[model samples]
Target: MKGRTIILDHLNGREAAALMLDGQLEDLLIACDAPAPGTIYRAVADRPVKGQGGMFLKTPDGNAFLRQIKGMAPGDELLVQVTGYADEGKAIPVTHRVLFKSRYVIVTPNAPGINVSRSIRDEDRREEILAVVHDTIDTVPHGIILRSSCAAADDKDIADDLISMLALADQVLNDDGKGPETLVEGDEPHLLAWRDWVEPAEVVTDEGSFETHGVLDAIDALSSPRVELSGGAFAYVEPTRALVAVDVNTGNDTSMSAGTKANFAVAKALPRALRLRGLGGQIVLDLAPMPKKDRRGFESALKAALRADSIETTFVGWTPLGHAELQRKRARLPLTELLN
Candidate 1:
């Protein structure tokens, strides 16, 4: 209960996973009926939008929109992977580039190279991992990327994962089928949690572990928009159809720097808030009324926080009405939508 723990269980008849750190829920993943991101499909090009430089494809799971056209013509067949979830009535967002990812290795069919994660700054570790890669992989038809989890991983285990992913990539790429079909399905919630949450943590798989470990309570709290931040400050993360709106409120201490301090707290907690709620896309922050000079500090704190996050988010600078704007990747479906 004190250290990190990974809990796998069912929520609302759907498989769910939760990551807890120091007795606090840090991340959550829940399965849904929609087409999960990373699903590979051999689709037939339906038609290209005249001026949008994008094309829609016919897949088993309804229409999928893939941006970036490269002389693509109708009736042509190509392999595409679902990139992220789409809004209601919108085409599933997909990309031409497909990546085969596993716990330790990611195979890139388009890019060819054996690369190590930049986080492994130790030269010796890099050399050792590279040695493993070179030894495990003889012929490189696809690029191999060693994830950060490989830093302290066993040599034999890393090699095994690399081999397995390489074989999978080859099998998917070499499919000679002519009709549109699904090549591979996306990883489920529990499997995805295992792949990404590789940090040392206690594993909880017993029945009713979610209730025993307070995971259900934590998820219930997420139903509310109010997120209590440090120093008694709070923030509301409400997602509308168009965008996510965040409003920060100062803590109980009404000091001269109360607004600035509350704003800093919001900045630090914002990423985790959005992450647990699975909220993304356009985000606008109406931070507490701090002095204009303090805006730079808030931005710096938010940028640093987001940099530490794994999700792809871009801080698009402040707005004219003294608000902050951000563009985040739609990597997962909204938690509320899935739960409901």
Candidate 2:
């Protein structure tokens, strides 16, 4: 594993932590900010946006977008899940489709199915767990996805989590008279990311962060725009108004294979750096120039590095300048914003 270390660095005056992985700061989840993703809210369709497809929803926490107009109308109460955070007066993206996330499983209300995590690679174990989940899911039209945590969980744990999630969903569904009300608050960002994406072997936190949920250890990494990879390779990250650019350069004193090795090193470290920095939207990686024929190998390495990211990412292929172009979904403000 290229980026395996995990550290929770507490920040000053915030109920949040900077999740550092392999010396890069990845995400910032603040307790006082907008609702976390997976948070369920009871909202009413406040008004329809003119010429736009979706209507604005008034929730207890903030305004959300219900991006369909056909079956929804003003003053109609509905249950929605937060997909991303928003700035003041900006509507957070939301979905009527809800997923109740827990450490072990995600229960979808009124939908009946069982999907296991792709990370669960054991076929026999998957089948066995699927059997367990299937037997546990009864009567409710709820669907379930047994997360990676299920691999370590017993039958009782799975069953209990499932029942609790289902019960919560039912409660949200049956509740009435809502303007903007949070039905459920979500877990901290670090914890959520750890459960959903990277399963770190260890979690280290400073005394302050460990005690008060602050992020102090990741300050330097989160603020710096450079990442030094193994061997003599490094990346200089610059965020511009249009996009973020990463220039990969080789260090002093190298071998004939240094270029290829450096490119491979960048392929591994670049994505981890971008992810940890939470620098999304358009991203361009300027390489140290390699043979066109070897481009595929480098590209594959980059894609493999980002395989575990919870955010959706798309590789737009290489650029004419021997650079790689990619895009990641942007929801909340960049992680860099918090550091500043």
Candidate 3:
């Protein structure tokens, strides 16, 4: 994903359009416009019609801005410049826009679907939450869920985000301001909220040294599931060429039949390989071709082994070449790829 910076004059639609068209902004950041706060929008530029270009802005706040003009319009034209490469280092255009002064607020039910008639003061905070919510709701509805952030938030956080927005809005609102206006900006990319939510069993990384500070502080606070530091595990990568080979070693497990043990080993190794290698596409599994007496035992053992990983594996019977075929879900990267 590419990052961007934008400036807008007040809540002028024309200025927004110019920045979007010129910068070819893919994502937009609006500073103000509370009441449906933190709303992020996507700008779709219509194909040039007879030398005239137009743009349509779709925001979660149920607001849209459209512009139809052949060239630039007057009065502080939206100025947007972007730096990002796409598809073989080609410049892909993106649209960015900001609204000055207007902040947003979102009124979510205390308990989803349970709307209560409650009023919250702290105008400063209310406006801020509204603005950010309005911008974020469109793109990341699932991401920014209404948590304690709104509960007794006293609008403190709201005020903070709002005040921050106002500072940016004020800068753009100023007529004497020299540089391009920046209506809104996103925070640093880190899973602060995720850390606050899910308590992982443990967080192991290869970064070395285990001093929990800064972003990792929240991870340290988790109880029940304590976080531990350890050197990263080894990762295995898949072969790039079309043809690849996997040699299965039985090692030593005398407790189970040879065929059953072999099947279990293969099943146990599949998930690790899939994840580490970032492997996609089809995967073919060749189990040790065992005698007829062990055939049923092998199939049963394979099924049992797959259950441990919560992955579905089909026997597909046996092939003429004595190989077993199975299908697994395709993940962006396989475990083996990452491990390698």
Clashes of 2: 13
lDDT of 1: 0.92
Candidate 2 lDDT, 224-301, residue by residue in tens = 788887786887888887898988888873677667777899877776577656677788888875678888888788
Candidate 1 lDDT, 238-264, residue by residue in tens: 999999999999868788998899999
Instruction: Give a tens-digit lDDT track for model 3, residues 1-340.
Output: 1222122222222111001122222212222222121222332332333443643322322223334444533332342212111122222322343332221222221223311113445566455555555553343211122333353444555445444544554444343433223333322112211212122222222232122212122212321111111121121223334422343434443443554455555655555344323343445554544566776766676676655432344445666876665554432222222222
The 10 consecutive residues of candidate 2 with the worst lDDT sum are 209-218
How high is each candidate's TM-score?
0.98, 0.81, 0.31
Q: All predictions: root-mean-square deviation over Cα?
A: 1.0, 4.0, 17.4
In TM-score terms, candidate 3 sits at 0.31
Sorted by TM-score (best first), the order is 1, 2, 3
lDDT of candidate 2 at residue 196, scale 0 to 100: 52
Better of 1 and 3 by lDDT: 1
